[model samples]
Target: MWRCALPPLHRYPTVDELAARAAALAVRSSGDVRLRRVGVSRAGTPLWLLSVGRGARQALVVAGPHANEPVGGATVLRLAERVLADPRLTAGADATWNLLLCLDPDGLRRNEGWLNGPYTLGRYFRHFFRPGFLEQPEWLPDGADGAALPETRALLRLQDELKPFFQCSLHGVDVGGAFVELTRDLPGLCRRVAHAAARLGIPLELGPYDTLYWPRLGPAVYRIPPPCPRDLAAAITEAAVESTWYHPQRHGTVTAVVEAPMWGVTAVADGSPPADRDGALRTVSHALRRDARVLERVLARVRPHLDGVPDAARLLAPVDDYLLVCPGLADAWDPDTADPLRPLPPLSTAHLTALRIAGGRIAVRTAGLLHQLVTRAGRDPAGALPELDALIDGWCAGYRDDCGARWIPVARQAEYQARVVLAAFHLAGARSGESDWGSQPVVPMHRE
Candidate 1:
């Protein structure tokens, strides 16, 4: 019996390197891997497309859409290989494939070296210190033009052209477990994936209250206490929740996106069972096979709705507000480790005030201050701040029961120390809405 080998999938690659790799695979597999330029990176580097297999239909899978969360890039590369080698996977009766792998080259290049480094225990932990997007090779808009980023443009173009039957964007969070967020209901698919995890000895926490394995997009994936439905995308889009993704076409198709947690995969791959590099690879291989089965089952059951699903973006506002409020504060209830990497801290008074002010201006209603804090923090994290290094380290140490630090269960820890710093930033932003931080000038501090 051949066991799968775990390859170092965390390593990030530059646009050129990724393109070359895709190109190489395409060459090796001949028609199995077709290389073409989808778009250029923000920095003007070419982003390549790799398509394998044959079918009348197409499925577009994108990885590394964000600059920071990049586990999907590796997953895509592996999936590409599998599709090329396994004729059964692509040539079956309903087979079709058009994989769009690694959209944000600029983001990946910034930390590519660290991403590709050794996969020892120490190396894994060391990755937390790698710099964020300020060092990224990608160009980010100045909040004026979101998705103005070139990579996003290419992605939108692909969506316009392929109008795929299935669409998934691969993203990973520091904490949280694996979960799939469908554009629409894929009940059997979720069950298949969940069962696959269980079979692999990976923990499976489904249904509401499974914060570690929740999705914000579809209904019924995350159940807040008392059975409240928490749809991340729907919550964000209160103004309209009826039609989203691509306008529902009468003769249209369904798009399925998988929001897999990097840590969840890693924990399953390298947890107490001690899955080394090779073991992790095998786990991934098995997991993908299960994913295929789930997708096939779901497709067989649900007819695609031609009308586009509702674009529920308004619901995300409160969640985004809560995330901006603190670091690691939101992770107090996760059943996972104390600190996997990025944890949401509590919201500061400044952030609360900002939310209040913004809400009042927009006539939006929200829960009481404390409840808002807990609920918003509970949602998946949107982003993080820089000063969280020490707190994260301490939490990680606590997970291992280090002698120097007191450990708290992830769901139990109080707000993070970074909350104070975030509050300060909010205060700074609020005080001088127009002035830069340096110009507004807060007092400097010296360490004792």
Candidate 2:
């Protein structure tokens, strides 16, 4: 039987908050959930691992690699707790599971205030435009002379020591959809995972990143695309590809990668909520349970094939495209390309056409505001939140028309828009009455 004691939605834990919760839970269950500090993050934050059901062979699941996407971290921690709370479910599992719950502490912390802090609505808006990548501590590679970031070095050491049979690094795509990759064959397993996700009410759609969501149209909207494969590998860069499972097929240790949909804990019509707590928890909890069930079934079926997976020793021609997209951030958001987060300058004719290309309903006023904020955001986000939020609301309201052929499912899209709105609200709450920079007082910057 399920314990049913999980916290309500209002109390859903953020990445750091979950760490303390996981640590406490591990301590309480001393024999079941063993907590270990495997490494320190680039910011010297402890990278925690919670182990359950000890066995000879091991499997690893890591989350929070990028930080802002902390749902996977929270999900893994909850899964660990569930495992400890219910041993029979995880008992006799051929492989022991080692979960790295929150791989990117530095990135997680920077946005912590967005969920927990208090301020006026105005402050929250300005804070939303903060450039996460530029502030990401993990991306700062090793200095030429001698040293790598302590966190990076520690992770390398752990990989050498543990040599996990399977590795799953979890992250979220703002756009809705799901995708999975394995170095070699894991047919029955991937399909089973999809089946379980469907049972939990998540969409079964899987594809490359570009095909996952319809392209943007105007303010606060996206287009839904027809069925297609979204190249997720081509989306982000420097993401431990050399060390993940695909590394062999290309050159890495990560064996499997799965991209989950972008929905939040609750349901929202556009992006605002009824502010219901229990309802959201019930929905999300069911999803998590379903995910676990899927993973369990798939692992059982795939164990026999693990030994036969193509080894690094195989001689094969290098696939250029896979190699090009393996760099995590580079693949996701190319620095040289037009920044997705940044919009065109307000009132500019070119700005209108860009929004038109993105597709859906066209709102001249909303588009102009969002365009200005995104443009100014490239320079100063703290000054742009309020305007951003107003723009976001407009976009959210116009989602149906504005969403172009991007594949964001209707339900998940509402959830994502709500999360984005809440995120904007949090940023708007960062400060009160503002100081002067230009003629216009700074308003919330909502990207819609």
Candidate 3:
């Protein structure tokens, strides 16, 4: 009985490190661990599909589906080992597990610089590499000779071929506690999944309800939310739901994505009673307007400087347009209904600071990318990069000053995420069986 100790969770596993871990599992399992080369990345990195456990129902787990959210890969690797350490964990269950670890390796490679080091707020924000919305794997264009990366093509083929009955991809956000997005509304599944997460000490995200058009499944669970991918993507991106949603040519299947916070901000789940409800709602509305204005002002400030940058009109919109997008999509629920999501948590002073740090970092990175693009395209004949660090630095310094930040261990984030999903997968595995064998095997995994 061997349990792999989780590394520091604040940092993520490198692509090579995770790949080697997968190969090592195969060796330890005496050839039972089957490694499939789903496809090769653009940079020649092998995209691996690790197949372990045996059962009737097919389950596919995509980790690191979004390159910027790297912790999913670590969580998947941990879950994979969990499944392997005890064969009976899946014995007599319905699921045969398959995982695509780091589906976008090129993007993963690009983000390697920030994975291991300086896991500081500024370091993460400045170093993070988020592809333009269209280039993201979740919404990659599938047309002939489209700008799709090599890895996207491989995933399309694998998904179409496997036609999995259950599919999900792992994702996490830079701030906030855990939340889930479901393709369908199953209250029973929600209770089970949410409770599982709670036992792990992971709080449900009860922040501002920004998902206005989607069905609120549970406390933090939103179902088939809209402001759909195409809503924002159409203007600046070629992203569409047809490409984004899991359609294995079947019905009665469920797909889920869980976003875990990189750090613990206890304020995310504050459902405390309030004295003045109307005033609270007014404050919330005021905050939304303020955020929108701030974004607009920033965009205005940067507009003139963007002239030398290419695609300035199309791509740069999201840089500040995200403000408009978010406000337009704010939680517009009537106060009469059980509007629990609205009153759950006030953005703490510290949380707001962290959120600003994320926003500011993203803004700086956006400008930095534009600077790189303009120079690389020879739009800037002098090869000069746009100046942004000083502006970003100034804001970060202010953020640090009245700062109330907490650095939750990377292990806790990964464990809370892994345990909940493991419980859900175990539940799915049990759904295919007649009797419940879940209660017994988990102890060994925990204490052995």
Residue-wise lDDT of candidate 2 within 246-335, one digit each (tens)?
322222232545455543211111222225433433333343333334323433333333343332111011112222232332222222
In order of TM-score, best first, we have: 3, 2, 1
- Point to the candidate with the largest TM-score: 3
**lDDT accuracy of residue 137 in candidate 1:** 19
lDDT of 1 by residue, 1-448 (tens): 1112333333444456566667767776746568888888767877677777666555566666655456655556656655554444455423455556676665566444346555222233333222222222122222213445566567666766776555555544333334444444443454444443444333222221123223333221321211123343323222112222332222254434343433322222212222243332233334333333432333222213212323222222332343332222222222232254644233222222222222221111111111222233443132221212332333344323421112112111101111111122222223333223223333321111
TM-scores for every predicted model: 0.50, 0.51, 0.74
lDDT of 2 at 257: 50
lDDT of 3: 0.59
Question: Which regions of candidate 2 deviate over 4 angstroms?
Answer: 1-12, 85-91, 116-147, 210-254, 264-401, 404-448
Judge candidate 2 against the unseen true structure and give its global Cα lDDT, from 0 to 1: 0.40
Model 3 misplacement above 4 A: 2-10, 140-147, 186-201, 208-212, 225-230, 233-240, 249-251, 272-387, 390-405, 430-441, 444-448
Q: Report the C-alpha displacement of residue 288, candidate 2, in angstroms.
A: 35
Best candidate according to lDDT? 3
Each model's lDDT comes to: 0.38, 0.40, 0.59
